[model samples]
Target: MLRFQDWQENQREVFFPDTVAFKWQMIETFIDGEEYDRSHVITESKWLAEHVKQGEIGAQEEYKHYKFNFSGNGQIEVISNGFTVKM
Candidate 1:
């Protein structure tokens, strides 16, 4: 998962590295009350040309699947779309 400070923060265009073999995008949807909810989905742009290439960090399916380290208190919550998704 990607860490976004706010729903709007995820709305801009992004890219996978030249090495990755897929496409992905992050988006947000506004539901009932006031907040917004965000989601990331893999968009098909390319697939790794070779099976062995998949293991390299550069060969992940999509840019979004790349890992990033997050550090914080054990309880973290996202407030959005008038709902909260706890992590």
Candidate 2:
């Protein structure tokens, strides 16, 4: 398993290699009054692509499946483990 620091470092490398102008925007949704929540880090396109790739890899490794659905208004839903996280 990747440590949180390692994952953050990887994200930094992927999103901001030489420039510091970009930053991660936290996108979160509260479920059940914040007892359960879903969150994502909004970054550059390359970084988001890598994030999705990692999610796909994790699903395959765990023998699970993921379904991603996008709506017309730029909302995304990632369905996995019988739950959906909107992004």
Candidate 3:
């Protein structure tokens, strides 16, 4: 298992590049102390994408940042972390 600090640094260097740059102080991720695995980290969404601008289903107002939940397709509902919705 890689060190927690080491793995987190690598994740920041890898994922949010083009529109999102890797800023160690600016990143928020999950690193299970026992292991340094890619499967364990979580990346926060900026919610500044075009799909958000299209607006949400049945929503009367535009969303700046959202703490909404959607049940994904599957036998079990996947309730992901609340994400932001931006244009």
Candidate 4:
């Protein structure tokens, strides 16, 4: 199993830099096998890029940073300020 920190580092060094270089309007996530909407949470691609560059695998809003948990089975759990969304 890969640790979250290690995954974060890999994201920062490779995945984000190579894949997430475009602008986005929203981010979707899943938690406990259920989808959750978070379109209102993140609206700027620059902000998201900044976090990604900073070795973060999640989003941020209102000065709070959300974290993410990546499952090896092509799934990701987004831990937001109020809820967890897995995708």
Candidate 2, 3-51: lDDT as tens digits: 1222233421112112212222244332233222223333233433454
Candidates' TM-scores?
Answer: 0.20, 0.17, 0.17, 0.20
* Local distance difference test values of all predictions, in order: 0.29, 0.28, 0.24, 0.34
**Reference-based TM-score, model 3:** 0.17
Off by over 4 Å in 4: 1-39, 58-87
Q: Higher-TM-score candidate among 1 and 4?
A: 4
Best by lDDT: 4
How far off is residue 75 in model 1, in Å? 24
Error of 1 at 50 (Å): 8.1
User: Please, what's the RMSD in Å of model 2?
Assistant: 14.1
- Which residue pairs in model 4 clash with each other? 29-86, 30-85, 30-86, 30-87, 31-85, 31-86
Candidate 4 on 23-82: residue-level lDDT in tens? 322354443543242223333334555766676544333332233333332333222334
Cα deviation at 34, candidate 2, in Å, is 32
Arranged by lDDT, best first? 4, 1, 2, 3
